[model samples]
Target: MEEDTDFRIRFSSLCFVTDHVGFCGTIKSSPSDFVVIEIDEQGQLVNTAPSKLISKILPEPNNFAKKTKLDLQNLSFEEGSNQEVSIFAGCSGADQYHQSGSEREDTISDGTSKGEEQTVDDLGTLLDEKTNELLNHFACDIKEKWNSKTELIGSSPEFSLGRILDKNQRAILHSAIRQKFPFLITVGKNSEIVVKPNLEYKELCHLVSEEEAFEFFKYLDAKKENSKFTFKPDTNKDHRKAVHHFVNKKFGNLVETKSFPELNYSAGNPNVAITVRFREKTHKHRKRSLFEYQDRKVIYTDDSLRLGQLKGNHFDIVIRNLKNQINDSANLKDRILEAIENVKNKGFVNYYGPQRFGMGRKVHTDQIGLALLKSEMVEAVKLFLTPEDLDDPVNRAKKYFLQTEDAKGTLSLMPEFKVRERALLESLHRFGMTEEGCIQAWFSFPHSMRIFYVHAYSSKIWNEAVSYRLGTYGSRVVEGDLVCLGEDVDDEHFPNNKVHLVTEEEESANTYAIHQVVLPVLGYNIQYPKNKVGQWYQEILSRDGLQTCRFKVPTLKLNVPGCYRQILKCPHNVSYQLKEEHDTDVKMEGSHIDEATLSLLISFDLDASCYATVCLREIMKHDF
Candidate 1:
């Protein structure tokens, strides 16, 4: 009787036992017997017995056999191998079987050439090709199911097979398919795939309001040619103007080919840029007008304005010491670095820098804000228009006329560019000189300037609060101290510098950083911190004879919801260098010097809403 043994198999061939246990794997020959490296249901590879195993082949409906044979031939060759070989399987067309590592000589299968021998390299290639074909078929089946069910197929068995084959390769293939096909697919940050267009697409379609669309279309019909519209300077313009302008130029207007935001060169810091749309016919003229309008308008001589250039809220500044005064007792470089590090680690009390107020010694802009808050319109108007003797002759003459002459007569003396000021004077002239008339006249000023005053007052309140907090608590957090979690604005748990009061347990834990304390920007909607800090906020407002509810100005439609901000800021990417000054005639620190001196140059970036001068004050330990 002949001895019974298991049969040899190709890679990725599905096999079944008499007991109906099924597996897919490549076959390898051990010294004594044949073993199948099986891929389990979980897509993990494992060794199993090949005894009583039978191959299960699934046939395709059209040209299945021919395509399979072609695929096998195409994929069988190993990379960089020169040898030519053929694969023969034991099936309906085969006549002989060759066992791997058997001592007996190879016998030809009926379909292959007689006396041809197979190499180990040929067998490995055959296995690899079949394995890849199985994986591709598996991936396609999973994709079809995913499309039908309209659900994620990440946990599907077929997807697991494809993942086992190649992880990054499958991702690239899916991305390409999504881009090429008509169907839309969205992949989220967590790799969750959804068959839907992005939310931004829907938002783009509905960006223009019905009222805006009607007005824009009405103007387009009347004009026929593209119209040049300029927004009122110094006014608080709506941000939606940009969106409306974009939609009108892209789809509504018949003549316009492009649209862009118009750069406002005259608006001071935190300037608002207007949106402009134009046709090909007006493009050249509009371009020329922009150059003429903004030329020499910026405060800095080196700055120039173009149509689309917008200002960023954040800025980086470099400050250098004009003269490096060296002393044996102290090293300037070491002192500067130590000062910066100390501020970074220990934190400095926050204050509204000099720029928040007007530049002149006689006027404080915060006072104007306070007068507006108190509804003292006459004071607000006087502060806005009155020019000191130090001001330019043109401005001084205009101020003198406004103070001494009647409102109607003073209008003629005001400059043409003083549109807001002239409007206020005209209102005062028409409404009479009562308190109500003065209030109405103040209302004629630009809404932005009115809001600026309110902001300046808020800054002053915050500066005082910071000073009080530091004076009482010093730099470290004590029991009942309020500490901010982190610096992320989008964190759901701690949005906008949310703080938690330190309990006795937390104080003992000592995990919270001392520099995490934040101060409040006083407004109607803000809840004041509990303790001395809260008392300080109340005292400041009480001293000014103002209430938090006063921030809700119904007449102006301005409601400020307050927010918390860090009491200290650290400079990032800080660096310093020393260079010798070549000029001898220049004065150093108000002293006449004939010798060349070394200058300390420092550079760093600061977060938005924080002043660079604040950091410099900490480093210099002196007022500017």
Candidate 2:
């Protein structure tokens, strides 16, 4: 067997020949299995695995023209011969035959020996044919692989050829390979690969470069600059008040402000929306107004702001169907009305809703609040900084780093966009890793967050007190019951003027009308009722190893000057409507009712502090 001495396949080398057909274009891959590309009759590259040519070897090229001409003539040789030679018979633009150690055949298979003589131009023509065939074959293979891999992964595949290439080098090589092969690989600025498809091979090969791909990817990953302002309120301020204060502080004058009704300043759902405008339409006014505020993400802008308010203290809820009866019962409205009246008379439990606690079944904010109340600074810091079980990857990383005592390291790992967390970590780094430092860091968090901890603890106590009061007294106002005077009273005041003890005469006069009884939210100035419900509140406070004075943290100024909350709530403006039943209503068995059955729609409103779901529970008498 003759050896091809001049050419050798090596790692990262471009190979133009394969085992299948002789005319396949270059492939840039590590040597693996024997794959080949061939030129079809239409001058397009085709991938094939012809068994006969698997063992065939091409002679090395001392000269490009001579070597290609010789290889083309040897394309039809019989298998397993030590020195087999073949003719380029019936091949387009070629008419000759060369046998090993023999002269060229004069009469071709087409019965024409004319122009059978070898020429330099013919060699060059063959070389171009081989080059074009190989290039086209390479492009087809790339397209096929790119499409299949992208489909399989549901994204672009990251190409890693070998360990020899560094990240940037690999990206450059990938760009070059994609250009020659006409694949859809896009090299990002950070060397990330993105796949863009259906580009014409010729056009793509000409237009794309490694630098261009890098820039294109960078552009893809670029973040849009926001021209709006954002402001979060202090823990003590309601969202409405916070926005008002923020606008006044920045603009020096109040702008047209529109905001939704604010919820209680609790630990959960603390976001508020508001829009403001400036008198002048200058970028300087917008930019100069911007200030560096920690524990808040603020945006200032000159864009026209349009927002609709979505919150109201009163809600008109429509409940469909009091009873699942299909027939139009004449007393259906009366039944629903009676249910609403029963709820009002019996009184609904005013336990703190799920929003008071942090998300999920387990409440985390209460733990942080308790730690702060007990002056356990280290525990408070840990509880506040660490993420909940359901937190995402970024939060988990921050938690892990903080737990591992890498406080300084956590600053870098923490997201720059999380202003609150960044402020906490920056405080920790500044104060040094001590208990006092931790407390200071905890304090440095958004005032709203700090207040949330205290509020959550108070809510926990309130919830327990309400549960105990309901279980014992069963919603009846007794002699010692503290009834709130009116609905529009704040809960955070000592010697609350809104609450008055229920006298024996008043309790007896309107036994059913006692819908509002006040309970103590334990704090320094709270006067617990001498009644049984107040005893439950004292028991809960004692069980948690807390006293009213414990809430007065002078350093933190988070003193909860105890307040009163109504023990019971009732819905008002009650009304009901009956309509024909739809397919959604589940029918009871053994009931013969036509399709024109009636359904109920009950509408009512409740106080802002009360949950409509709780009111519904009273009417439905089922767990919601």
lDDT of 2 by residue, 1-624 (tens): 122122111101211111111011111111111112222222222332112211123333222211111122223222111221122111111011112211112223332223323322432332346543543454455457544642211111222221222342332333333333333332222222222332222122233343433332222112112223323333333545644543343222212344432344345554444533322322335331122111222222222122221111233333433352344354555655565567755556665654455433222567778888887787777766666444643466567766686777776665432445555677888896688787688766445567667887887777666666666766477777777776445333325666777778876886534456777776776667668877777777777777454577666667777687776666554554545655332222323335544444444445545665555555644332
Flag regions of model 2 displaced more than 4 Å. Answer: 1-312, 316-347, 361-363, 486-498, 502-513, 548-550, 575-603, 620-624
Which ranges of candidate 1 are over 4 A from the true structure? 1-329, 344-347, 394-405, 417-420, 490-497, 584-594
Task: Give me the overall lDDT of model 1.
Answer: 0.43
Number of backbone collisions per candidate: 0, 7
For every candidate, C-alpha RMSD to the true structure in Å = 33.7, 32.9
Who wins the TM-score comparison?
A: 1
Clashing pairs in 2: 24-134, 25-134, 229-299, 229-300, 230-299, 235-448, 321-600
- What local lDDT does model 1 show for residue 182? 17
Per-residue lDDT of candidate 1, residues 1-624 (tens digit):
111111011101211111111111111111111111222222222232111111111222221111111111112111111111111111110111111211011112222212123222332332346643553454455446434743221111211111113323223332332222212221211221122221122223344443443344333322323465433232333445555454442333223222222343444433333333433432344332212211222232122222223211122232333322333245555555566666655444455665675533344567777887777777777776666555543365457755674776666555322345556677877986667887787666556656777777788777767767766776667666667876544111234436777777777788676557666686665566677888888888889989544586655556767677677666554555545656444222234446654444444444445555555556555444
- Cα displacement (angstroms), candidate 1, residue 110, comes to 81
Q: Name the lDDT value of residue 398 in candidate 2.
A: 61
Q: Which whole-number lDDT from 0 to 100 does residue 444 have in model 2?
A: 68
Global fold similarity of model 2 (TM-score)? 0.44
